[model samples]
Target: MKIGREDFEAFINGEKSITPYIETDLLAGSYSVFGVKTASNPNYLIKAIYEMYELNLNKKLAVKAVRNLFRSVGLGSVGLNNLLKKLGIDLKPSEFLMLVFKLQHQQGWGAPFELLEATDKRIILRTKQTFESQVMKDWNMQVCGIHQGWIEGVLMAVTGMNWFCLERTCHAKGDEFCEFVADQAESSWKFKAEAIVKGESAITEFIEHKPVEGTIKLIDDPVVIMPRFVFTSMMNSLKKTMGEMPAGGVNYRAYMDMGKENVEHYRKMGITKPHILADMAFTFYSQMGWFRIISMEWNEAKKEKTITLEHTVESEAFGNTGKNVCYCTAGLLAGIVEGSFGIKVQGREIRCRSKGDEHCVFAITNKPE
Candidate 1:
């Protein structure tokens, strides 16, 4: 049946109107196999097709045209086979054909399965269309011919993130340095280099001969931005080690310090009970780590279904909160438990009076499982 965007979205979200096997088979085609029958629920199918294949469609109708032309020439099978082959998809011809038909039209293949994989590699990179196209157009008009380079610089500047290839001659000098010219084979670098090599000499000229105003402005950050630079680097390191970091590094760092200090200060006020500190951490202190208690229960059984962990956590307190403790207690415990014992805590709780608070205590919890 045809699927609409909403239906596709539902199916993708793990909504259960359909069976897993059906969903799995449909997604296997990369959502580019839609035909007469699957077109019945056009809306959901279309939605899924677009959602699943949308990123692939970023470049132009070129992909659609290519696929359609292949189909028209009785090479749709060949084209689908080619894509599936690239994706390492192995399925029977009948099974693969059914999926191919669903994907060609339905667009509801949301699983990040072969469809997204095929389309992302095949389409997104070559496309000039993106959410920023309009913004780039307006920016280009405003700054004369410096629009493209300027927009790229602005993007780097605004995001406070850096991208560089290992072998690039130039790298972001610092957090705010923002631009690099590297001769590397990374995907983004290749795109930039190829764009320069093939296109209007403007992009190449712009990069080689920097735009004075843009260059100066990109590097000219105030003194206040230094702490931000440090915090960003720290967060990036943390995120790389873990899977992700809190969305806002600056806000998260500030609050985390505050939570640490609140505990320290409270202890200085002569609080000594662990429960009080745990309560404080749960209500106030734990916010900094961007932590949320996933599941905390007293495991009474002899922990067979558990493991151990260990790691060093930079400790902070309210007074001069950014300062890391010589040795952090809670972080130490978590590292030991998760790393060595193979037991993961929903979070950690600890009591320390080193920084000043007498009854200061805190718990660091994992965001969620």
Candidate 2:
């Protein structure tokens, strides 16, 4: 059966007024046929699951499976463990089936972060700081005020890393920012602040930004707000739908310290200036030469900025950070900074660095509008 766009929209929007059976139909359409049971014989078990549960199982159920028994009743609303306790089922199949039910019934599925793509070198940052930090609050303003894209990046990185809403015990002066009250998704990650000052310069220092000669600007200044909005939406969606990772999964402190220390080391080694740093790092990693600004194409209508130049780079340096980990650290740094700042920094080529020298100076500056 063909599902109309409006019906799909209503289903996704959670308009409880609609018929619940349709949800089951939607799930059956998307996930009913998995292991190939054609006209000869259909997967009755799977069919029972759809008919009994009457829940949408597209991305959610595809991620996991659910049992017909528990979902048939109202037990589906409770936690997997709680539901198991209520049902008094110890079988492995029972537990697995419950997980499947949870996945199918889950309101939203899929990692919101996956939707994020690199545009004009925009990046998503993952930071380690209390969202309430007066410094970070101010830093956020600095980023969003100048570049709107960074707002979403900051929100996602901050909340995804579990630094959104801070508690009273959080160490921000004046309590200027409130703890993050649950947003629509009821996330625990939260913090409040009126301003974003330059955060612990040590960690945030890794963010690098470059000016492209040609920027596609929107006629009504829409591009200016695109990146930040995108980041914000993604983070909010994750907070609401995707719960937190395990306790020890993401060590924000470690990532922050490592990023800071690396940047400081680069600075000490004389990657002090932003322009120079960008030049040298790109050259060393991409093995490309830089020339002074020759020309720029700024597309205000599209909010895209492009810089044109010529240089040589090594192919190996641009490979992934696993086996060909030439510029892993540098590449990661570039991604973090670009994502956080919502800027683009690309290389035309790559080059091998001298022995005992695995670093280069990158120049970054916050150009005040």
Candidate 3:
């Protein structure tokens, strides 16, 4: 696992391939996750989710589960394997890692993921402003569990060795830069993205069909793409943090404004017709992987919008929680309607997968005074 002296010489002699092995679809306003298009959410929002899970689960258990959940993110970068093989030159393991980390930086995972040091027993990696750490700077502990797991999975992929990746320091923990250390492992790993939470199963996957249908739209918004699990993990974390409130109240209230703020960009485009506005909103929503709409009813005279979604991610995240938990999504729809239709509306999740309903239903009607 050590970067041999010859490897260092190869790297220093300018024989390294600087070409990145990742592809980001900037025109489509998204990043490709194993060829599946994904949208971005605010980093602080995702940070809060990590805190929520930290609040609920024991530290060790949470770390272990998360490491497993994000393993796929690293393992899916098979492109790097091809890049290395095509070089057709003998390079040391450390050189390969250095190039791969540089590719991660190019792909926007960090400003620059640099190889700090390499020894017979360990390899040290460093980055100052990792997206994960930057968002969690208010905390007293490291928060790049995703990156740690990424290292573990990618190291295994490159070297065909089980490497245990650990965060030695983090910006969230008052460190100058987030640092990760990797050492060979004795095979204590599992591919369990659907780790359980409070006796319920977390969602294992979204977009059952690989390589989601149609080309990702060449939209006009800038995005930061990570694995789909990060979003699901955020929702699952919300369920844990809700604690005593009626299942969905906390989630519903905290994120209601998100939709309203989001719709403003579309609203300013001068699309006045309510149905057109709704269509615009739903297209953005669907592309973000929230749900696949089964039906949409926009009542003009009544000023109500009823939407039924078959693949509700919120319900899937909490698996059989025995009560309606798409309240956050309902609040989102309500806000979207208020902004899109110019009406004050009462929104409700009338059906939810958690309650064993086949389709999740949200009814947005005019709010009574």
Candidate 4:
């Protein structure tokens, strides 16, 4: 099953029929391991991982675990090896590293990266932005362990060699850039020190390095995003931690923030106004396989409107939590309303399929005047 640009784009656009197992196979190379859809908000995905890191209390162990998991998956059937093979590039060591960077960019991780140096014994790369760093910008921590592991995993899969990846500097640690060093040596501290000195001595050296020759151009294909299950599971984990307190409140606030960010993001793209933004939001969610929008209406006279969305996959899968568990969706809708109208509005999930309702429904209304 060769995944071409058209196929990839179709999959991202929800024009391709995807079963849970197949999607998992395509992305993570295991069959139904996640048992959910692929494609998700990167921020949500990183947050879930960060939460896990905090829960474990041992950042090293958490990072090691993540690396091992990613490595194992990358070594599996239909994984990174297969992806590289499909690209059909006869790449040198440096070119291969550049190819990896290109693949990462194509996957929508939202960062521009460069291969500063690559040799048989060592490789250095730098990025101004990274998904984890961008997501954890406010936190005082280094969150590049997963990425370090990912690089190691891919290298191992590609070269059949044990390579160690270390994050010498991180944006989360207040550095101007995130720097990664990979080598096959047992001692990585020396490489880390070198990277630090090099980064300081001539930062522009890395930035000004000419692009590698014969770079493989990545196809503008759709990325296989994560599924709703990933976010839902993370929410459920938080709920478990909250115990007696209602978890919906946390989800509401978090998702409302996300929605507001989405609005700001779209606004920069020249998408403003309630109706147009709502339609754009609906299209985005629907394309990501969240649910079908049955109806969306705006009542200017009553300062109220309603959106009826049905067949929400999250609600259908979790099945009757005895309360409206779609708080995030509600918050998102409310955020869209607020962003669109430039006024405060409230959104409520009046009916949820998870609560044994036939459809999940949301109501939006302006605040009391």
TM-score of each: 0.17, 0.16, 0.41, 0.39
What lDDT does each candidate get?
Answer: 0.31, 0.28, 0.64, 0.62
lDDT of 4 by residue, 81-120 (tens): 4644565534555555555445445445424567888888
Judge candidate 1 at residue 310 and give its lDDT.
20
Candidate 2 segments whose C-alpha is farther than 4 A from its true place: 1-180, 186-369
Per-residue lDDT of model 3, residues 150-205, tens digit only: 77777777677777777888887888988899998564111111122121212221
Model 2: per-residue lDDT, tens digit, 223-340?
2213323323433344466443321112222333444444444445444555444333332222112222233344576443343322112112222222211222333334434433
- After TM-score superposition, what is the CA distance of residue 310 in candidate 3 from its true location, in Å? 38
Worst 10 residues of 2 by lDDT: 189-198
Error (Å) of candidate 3 at residue 136 is 1.8
**Shift in Å, residue 278, candidate 4:** 2.3
The sequence of per-residue lDDT tens digits that candidate 1 reaches over residues 1-369 is 454445434533446344322332455543222222221233343333333433533322222222222223332245445544555554443234334333432343211112211211111111112212222233221111111222222222222222121111111111211121212123243233233223212121223223554332111211111232344455556557664434233334444444455455445544445445444334221222322333333345533212121211232322233332312334432332333223344333343333443332444444445
